[model samples]
Target: MSTDPHANQFGELAWFKSSYSGTSGGDCVEVAATPAAVHVRDSKRPQAASLTISAEQWSAFAAYARQA
Candidate 1:
């Protein structure tokens, strides 16, 4: 999805790691949410590019994950 002109960039966003993730940080992703989008990136490489999806899409995926 295309980002709006006013959307928050990666550095400006506040990211969160999953509560279940290990403190030693093996394989996990960090997530950040904005009003219009959800951002996901590897916890090991925060500076790398992230996947951004619409909030609606994220909610749908989250529901599916819960079911899985």
Candidate 2:
């Protein structure tokens, strides 16, 4: 969880929110994808620190989530 924007070395990535997100904006996250990594952040606090993981890791996690 690097707070430094430069840590990821990806500049100004476009983030997309989940379609399941509600108007009330409860627990939800927005994700930005790049060739090398996937960035995840709280939709409620877009300016806050984000979690960065490899694209492969994200794909695996997404597959596991689909199973659940």
TM-score to true structure, per model: 0.83, 0.81
- Cα-based lDDT for every prediction: 0.83, 0.84
Off by over 4 Å in 1: 1-11
- In candidate 1, position 59 carries an lDDT of 98
Q: Model 2 scores what on Cα lDDT? A: 0.84
**Could you give me the TM-score of model 2 versus the true structure?**
0.81
Q: What lDDT is reached at residue 39 by model 1?
A: 89
Clashes of 1: 0
Backbone clash count for every predicted candidate, in the order shown = 0, 0
Error of 2 at 39 (Å): 0.3
lDDT of 1 at 22: 68
Please give, for residues 1-68, the per-residue lDDT of candidate 1 as tens digits: 33532237444777899889969869999898998899898889887888999999999999999999
RMSD of each: 5.1, 3.7
